[model samples]
Target: MTKKGKKGPSVTAKAEDRHWHGKRVKARAAKNASRTGSKTLGPRKPGSSRAGAAQGRAAERSSGATRRPDAPELVHGRNPVLEALREGVPGTTLYYMADSDERVREAIKIAADRGIPLLECGKPELDRLTDRAVHQGLALQVKPYRYAHPDDLLQGTAPLIVALDGVTDARNLGAIVRSASAFGASGILLPERRSAGVNAGAWKTSAGTLANMPVARCTNLTRQLKAYQDAGCFVAGLDAHGGSSIANIPAADGPFVLVVGSEGKGLSRLVTDHCDLLAHIPMFGHAESLNAGVAAGIALYELARQRHT
Candidate 1:
């Protein structure tokens, strides 16, 4: 059985062995990576659901509708989160730092009492979640907001309703919502395109007033204005050089629709034509105009005062 200078095995066999070993190593590494990647969002600690709820969450993550159009989705900052929780805003999850402050602790307690899922994350994670907007180590995941149809709003006996033409700022929309709520307007009418919806920024700016207020999305602002006019609503559009002053309008005492346009462009030609009258807030000073939010607030306050008087 002894052979002189015989190699243990053929070079081809050694090469095949090394190739097989490399493949095995790669398979092991891939399996490890898969396990690690499963926990990319972080570890599943206590209070983190892992049953059907987890599966449903996974499904939501996989589906395109995880963040619905109407939902609030993300709300940051302590006041915003605290106010949202206090206002009973539907929260899906509450992301907070493990080492947080008193305000954050209060928010955490409220979220826990409300049965919201609490996920502990770091500051960097919070920053990433909120697009680096000073989250203050807290973020709330809210449910989608339910938007009302244009026709649905007409059914109510709202004395005054505000329709936005092209005010695209979310803060403006939020401020308008607050003003509308304060002045006892029925709801807000927003165009589906080229206008802002009730997003997180709007919700935060609204100070949780959006929870009580209903917003409707209109397909065509001009058509909606015309419908309001046809339904006996005095549709008045706001313009800098409007023919009549807001205080001089007698129709404002009755059920009317206040149409506010964008800050820069004012009302469009079609929307302007649909208005029963153009009402301007007279200013003796040199200031030409006010922002959409300010103008709407002043208009609403005026209308409310007239109605109360």
Candidate 2:
């Protein structure tokens, strides 16, 4: 039968009929063996159709089926590995290249302290483990990151929220999280679509600051920004032109949410329109633009400085 996307094996009543018939034949064979008092194993009495279906489902679950899509987690680099161990990121194993540097040696000590198994391997093995990322001589296997709900960040007191708009690079996301954590932001918000989600690369890039920072995902970033504005929080978007200077924004001292855009594409029109103010970092150099992480760090530092002073 033709499927929605492409044609493949038939998946219908005929296929199911064949499966049940095979089960019935096996049941008869088991009954014959029991009647003859044979040493061979025999099947238990079959149940109703409904019971059989439920049992099948239970068996599948008991077998630890991978029904959900879960991404693998691998944290690499000396700083990330050390930080992950310090933050208790639930590492399963640690890998260090042979003839490692002092940093990797220190990592091994920490891993041993935590009772995590360590493997000394060559560069090729480390490369395969980290998927060719810059491992810097150390790697750690970690569990998938758990993200927070948007409402979790909005409760209780007003928060300093940093929202991302279409930032697809995982490394950029991690760097932003590190900066946000350092600057006292309550949490980082990411849209459910068209944005990078937290992953091993991001976790590594954050230098394990991701363990402390709560990342919340939103269905619609613009809609959420509007809700924040309604709740007396100033909503601001960062852009390259025609906006208030980040250093002088009065809202920086108050409850505020900063929306940062992708490096290639600035904020989407819908997101930009929802902002109460569009702000930009003052630039005098010949460079036209800054990296997404750098931009976020600068804006966060300004807001933090304003709040402190």
Candidate 3:
């Protein structure tokens, strides 16, 4: 698909999932969503300004019906609420069960320090805010997420970057971001359309990574990759089938952009064509692939290991 007058990664959906991303420097390609039934917000190139805007629009349109314009929408579970309160992201209300356990109260103590109000409510109240939401006796009502820009990550010297394409699972997206930050990646990118944007679940998945990691969203993935190229960095994609082993390539550890595709489908064709290198992790047995998060963790470690070595 074309995004903002630029061509984006293309895919045909073969029996086996293929990857869709090009290699480049710091800038990143946005994400692309498949058109099974949902709306198409548009593909995001690597360096496009519209990436984050597109993501905001998609969240509005996709969840517009369920969310209220003004009210206390809930973020369930202790961790999600705890992180938001600690980070000072902003909140409307804090809800906890009247009989909330010890851990929940401790989390509330942290929120209280920030002057965030804590409401002690009944099971019915928690039930309404969450239908089997797994509140764990704690939930928070907070404002929507705020995304950063690619240039924000590039401010530091030899900054590391990560670009995600078509990662639909919020949990995976969150875990990946948490891993990125844990390993000291400077920036993270997601497409405006199909990829997972920051939400409560994603936020929780990060285990507070959103608070620390500088994540960027874009309208077009290819354009963003091009922008990274102009900045004097290398870009690469993780593919199960590719030209070089992940351990053999040097770019995996350099100041570059690392692109990962959807959980099932690897890289899209359009993004693949634009890549400077396609690297695969060497498999020893019948195993052909790995989880998106696992792949990211291992790949990122390889890069880190290379830089240190």
Candidate 4:
């Protein structure tokens, strides 16, 4: 008989070996899939790359969901929107919910005449855009105001600059801009923070003067005042208890920067220290203080008179 060195493995054993190998392969694949799923569902720690990516996505969504800070401002209400359009406030678009009202029709006409894009949106959309303010079926998207450098106002001989210290009222700022333009002021200076910016309210209150006036924003008011001083401009702070009257200031005849304070508080301590002189508006009436807008108007008139004389 032929010699057989060893008995070959049984067919049953061979089949069992294949079955075990297949089960092992399937188990490994399922384990890998579970691990990947866990990673997808896992909570990320703060400051981790994954967390940062999630935060970035959230920020993007938020920016898209609401109006951006630098976006064009919306002037709501039929009269306000119409007036803004009439005053030629730079506008990109005119949005209206209804055109039945006369004011709305007029505004639509004005916008069309000015070649501003007209967008007909629903009431809910208008409310969302205007922050639920009284839109009255009309809204005008005004262009953002462009600011000038603080040094840019140094042009012209004996340039007069009005610097606001802590004025936070937009309407007050608008009024001041009106007065500054009227008195031939070179420009208006404002602190970047804790101050009112050129907004719709300011545009309305300015009565078109904002278009002509140049407003400069500075990061540090005190340092900007020093820079102006170094440039041969006298820095004067308007104070109720100032040592000298605004009319008698010799600096008014030369390059000057008149700093106006807030209505509630006069000049800040740092600004007061940096001032070359503190000048007050003479008040014979019993009124102890004036609002920033009125005070600025009076002070500017005095300074203008001094310069002209």
Q: Provide backbone clash counts, one per model.
A: 3, 0, 40, 0
Please state every model's RMSD to the true fold in angstroms: 29.1, 25.7, 11.3, 30.7
lDDT of 4 at 291: 75
Which regions of candidate 3 deviate over 4 angstroms? Answer: 1-73, 83-90
- Candidate 3: lDDT of 73? 52
Worst 10 residues of 3 by lDDT: 33-42
- Candidate 4 residues lying further than 4 Å off, grouped into runs, are 1-72, 97-103, 122-125
Model 4 residue 303 CA deviation in Å: 1.4
Tell me model 1's lDDT, rounded to 2 decimals. Answer: 0.70
Over the stretch 112-176, how does candidate 2's per-residue lDDT look in tens digits?
Answer: 99899998888998776665767787888776667776655654344788999987778789889
Please tell me which predicted candidate would have the highest lDDT against the true structure: 4
What are the per-residue Cα lDDT tens digits for candidate 1 across 198-288?
Answer: 7676777787888888788877788776666555466777776555567765555555788998765678888877776666776655455
* Candidates 1 and 3, the one with greater lDDT: 1
List where candidate 1 sits over 4 angstroms from the true fold: 1-72, 155-158
Task: Answer with 3 or 4, whichever has the higher TM-score.
Answer: 3
TM-scores, each model vs. reference: 0.74, 0.71, 0.74, 0.70
Tens digit of lDDT per residue, candidate 3, span 32-142? 212122211122234444865575455443431224444345667776777766766566678888655666777678778878788888888776666556787878776
The lowest-lDDT stretch of 10 consecutive residues in candidate 4 is 34-43
